[model samples]
Target: MIRLSRIPHQLLTWGIPMGPLMLLRTRGRHSGLLRTVPIATLRHDGHHWLVSPFGDTHWVRNLRADARAELGRGHRFRPVRLVEVDDDRKLEILHAYRGAFGLVPFVRDAFDADAGAEPHVFAREAHRHPAFLIQPAG
Candidate 1:
């Protein structure tokens, strides 16, 4: 199962250009080396919200250590700083993500937003998802 998940991520990280798929570059939390991960990103109302479909994953930790990361799509890349969204906003963003992406299993499964769930269902645990508001890095 992990292998299956890795293939697409590997493709997006190095070899594909499909939709809004993006490559996020962050410094390794422990190694202090650069690490890249492909992420399915969603943007709304001029704000880019990054969802950690897989919970508070590695890249999330890396960002915690250093709030700056580079967002890359196709050939364009921009440096951005992560401003951790508060729980209230996280729930709202998660709702937007669910509606836009059709309840991604990785996220819905964790937040229990499957089928007919209220948009605010994720509120109680929104902090666990670790969403961020992106801003141009200074």
Candidate 2:
């Protein structure tokens, strides 16, 4: 259902804004097939980020096995290296994600921390939601 909803946004031209959503393409660990899903990104502290509001999901597992993935916004897809952010550095990203997207019910419900919660609140909540910093792949 989520994938279906994102198809239109995936087709839009790169110049147009599509909010924070992007199509994440990962190679399946078991099947070795390419899997795609729409996910929200956090652009914080001069870096692009990927946060799994739902915790460690399938895509997260796949990405763990293969850091090589593609992030597609509209018609433009770029190869990216997804480095799982360490807990120490993840607090700010989590806070930023909450501040930016916490209004959405799903995102809000995913964490125990409130939108205006302090950094430590997010630090405790960070384990449930894995975050990755997106870097341009060589």
Candidate 3:
């Protein structure tokens, strides 16, 4: 979904200091073509996870169809497996994100704007959105 070439320089500019940038290579559900995206990451307890602020994007759908993906951080490439969080864990992750980033209000407002609904309702739906924990393959 994100144009990699256009943002490569900018991505590296911001990615260098704020932890490793994630490159997720996934297969298109309909077209069966491979798609890659660079995303921000949060590492929790040795596991890497991605939080979808805009929930259910094309890349997320690709991961759902095929859990196996290639992750590139800087020049290292590693194989990762996607683990989708359940409802309870998703809530926990959301809270953890809010606490760690201290961006609760911004997150809430963003979800509201994206969903075009009231903050309360959109917040609830955002919590239900699927998030993935990426584990390095053994």
Candidate 4:
């Protein structure tokens, strides 16, 4: 995991064309070691949301311990909190992403490319995956 502390490097990575990766910095819950990881993200409603296609990764664990984190999206550093969406609304949110980003096939393949499952199946599984709706701290 690459912990990004420099704003310039972050910008260079995300700012460039085809740079969709975001650098998330968090403090380890038990080890207290600062860790950084790259993730896919989408911006919405003046906030950024990150979804872990792999589910509950290390960065997610770190954020769970401490909501405070620095998001490096294309050289932009914004302090944000990891907000867990209500389970009741998880499917709705996932659907919104699918519609907004045209991610039906993409998400389906992410969950199980070989399962030959429907979009609903993928959506249901995606709900179980860890996701963070980021909001900047005032």
State which candidate has the highest lDDT: 2
Each prediction's TM-score versus the true structure: 0.83, 0.87, 0.68, 0.65
Clash-forming residue pairs, model 1: none
Number of backbone collisions per candidate: 0, 0, 0, 2
For candidate 3, lDDT tens digit of each residue in 19-101? Answer: 44566677799998977776656666666677776677888888888888877745556788888886556655555454444
Query: Candidate 4: what lDDT?
Result: 0.63
Clashing residue pairs, backbone N/CA/C < 3 A, model 2: none
TM-score of 1: 0.83
Q: Give Cα distance to truth, residue 64, candidate 2, Å.
A: 0.2
Q: What is the lDDT of residue 78 in candidate 4?
A: 76
lDDT value, candidate 3, whole model: 0.63
lDDT of each residue in 1-138, candidate 2, tens digit only: 475546644553343556787788899999999887778888888999999988889999999999999988656789999999875879988888989998888888888999898878887777898999999998
Error of 1 at 37 (Å): 0.9
For 1-138, candidate 1 gives per-residue lDDT tens digits of 366557666666565785767788899989999887777788987888888766778999999889999988545678999888875677778777767776455555666565355758877666667788888999
Clashing pairs in 3: none
Off by over 4 Å in 1: 13-15, 73-76
After superposing candidate 3 on the true structure, give the runs of residues whose Cα lies further than 4 Å from its correct spot: 1-5, 8-20, 101-109, 112-123, 126-128
lDDT of each: 0.76, 0.84, 0.63, 0.63
Candidates 1 and 2 compared by lDDT, better number: 2
